[model samples]
Target: MNDSLTFCKAIEALAANIWPAEITAYLDNWQLRATRGVTKRANSVLAIGEYPQLANWLPHIEQFYADNSLPAIFHISDASPPGLDALLDSHGYALGTPSLVMIANSQDAAAAAAQKLVKRDVAALTAEWVTEADEEWLDAFLRLESYHEELKESYKGICERISDAKGFVKIRKGKHIIAVGTAVVQGEWAGFLNVVVSEAERGQGLGSYLMQALTAWSREHGAARQYLQVVASNTAAVSLYEKLGYQTKYGYHYRIKYDLRPLATS
Candidate 1:
């Protein structure tokens, strides 16, 4: 209802719209999303509204994830219904990664100045942009996944669903792409996502450069505010974003209920 809560909801809505799930359902105002369990964000129920219906929704939600072979999960944020945390705690749900949502004014003078250091090409994902993102970029982007072909296809599908004016950038040094990031402009807000720096290239200001590039792109596209979510335990990343003028608006975490049943003997 307040501005901060509204902003948080907007960011969540933009994310759900951009990175579409294979299936989505709504219970009252809570959003249930699932996507083959590839990512928690895509699979968890966003417990964001009134909770009078929560008791009834729980069984159905549990069955939905069980059918998909995923752990039943809920994304609990500051904007979530009051007492929901206690309810989940009573149900044996355990907390997962805690994350912070940070926001900053896109027109900040420091952000504007930092943009000057970005010399690498930072463009939106498109046919020509895909061509420009060479094998090096692909290799670096897929490092954590070990270039798993299926996950790469999912990434492409996610990118394709982003109808907003968005930018997917890869910064290269010589023949090797060292950093990547994405930004989506929605009205007065810009959401920055998937910002990564090569393991070998971090601590050299490349992360800062990528942030500035995304910030500048957002400002150019008429976004007055910028926000991003980072794992709360990632002290280094939290410090970097704070230095760049971002402040924590709220925090959220996932509550996961694993299916611990033993496998059937063959």
Candidate 2:
């Protein structure tokens, strides 16, 4: 493998832990992750490593998620098997949302955050770091996600299962928590998750305050690099992270095909 493909595989390996799924099963080298369809990352396939006898393996892969009442979906990245995307496309799998992985050196991100915090004049914003999440924090995070309230436990499971060093940082102005972000330190990388500024309070730079606090927390936990994944369609967030010194490290998308088995289960 070339250096670029090797690096991409490394990121995908780290990603498996950072945004863990409730269930991960393997068919050959293909990893299938699921969380009752609560989150895409948790439910999609990590199509990394070399392709096996895919013509034979694809059926089992589809049946796995079919048993779980989900469409089999593949997360396609640079490390994905050569021609896998085209094969899936030919087989009628639909293209899903594309996401970009953004990265920055921890020191550089921290420095940028420090400058942003000062220049943005967010002096009144006080930040708190909690090792464990509380109901309020989860509720706010759920609201920001625009996810159905019924999937709360699935989201909770994802967080509770994280075994790495993690800190949930929330920014407050007086008694009101205006923003929240989760930082997980795994080896040299700090993966940022569930970052959001209150809907009514956006355009006021509160997200920067929240990120700065996360940087400090991750740094103290021994992270040398910071990374986050953003949807390609989310221009505002992409722009913000670029300003904070994050650059696009890679891109991945999911290819999904709804199997009839799900309908039968339904």
Candidate 3:
């Protein structure tokens, strides 16, 4: 993309396909999404393209989430319209998670794909790659991520909703799955989601193996570039990506305040 804002919007579009919401409404240039508040990305208003008329849509936006028993959450970025953050601040929305959007070129993707677990570690690790996540793979991922029971269904729905070129990777040691990751290829861009390595498997190089397998999957699907979102505070993850040649292209955060104002019924 020519500018950061345009690039940011492009990533957001790719993300929508990779992490679909149960309900989506395109109001003006903003995308209002809700997935029962399972994850902030699937629940926030993606403020893109237009200068959101905050006053005009506040009530409707509030009531929309209220119907689902969630507060309004806005995904704010460097591209978000000027003063939007300030208005949210004035309206008492508390700032939330700060995340980074890191990107790597084709060379980096290939380099990661070249790293094979067979040569590095002592134990034999079996890597399996699939076009979609199955029940067994989903169970392993949920357990590794330690996701709540209430949120599992929404997460499963998100995985099922991906319609683009997608791949799911699972790394196993013996019979137990130790890692899970997903990659989606849209045009030349490959975006990663829900990458998790079992707690006991961390620091044993499985994360790198997982990334390599996912990179290979992306390459097979015609992706030439890679992007992933990581919380800025996650130093270990940030370090791993940086070593793979990823650089922070931009950053975004959520602005949220939980006040469930249910819609008025007729």
Among all candidates shown, the one with the greatest lDDT = 2
Estimate, for each residue in 225-265, the C-alpha lDDT of model 3 and write its tens digit.
99999999999999988877789999999999686453322
Put down candidate 1 lDDT per residue, 53-168, tens digits, no spaces: 55556777787777777888999987788898888888888999999988889877245436544553434211112323345444567872355756765565566667888877
Off by over 4 Å in 2: 53-55, 261-266
lDDT of 2 at 82: 83
- The alpha-carbon lDDT assigned to residue 128 of candidate 2 equals 84
Deviation from truth (RMSD, Å), model 2? 2.3
Tell me the lDDT of model 2 at 174.
79
What's the CA error at residue 254 for candidate 1, in Å?
Answer: 0.4
List CA RMSD, all candidates. Answer: 4.8, 2.3, 2.5
Off by over 4 Å in 3: 53-55, 112-119, 260-266
**Candidate 1 global TM-score:** 0.85
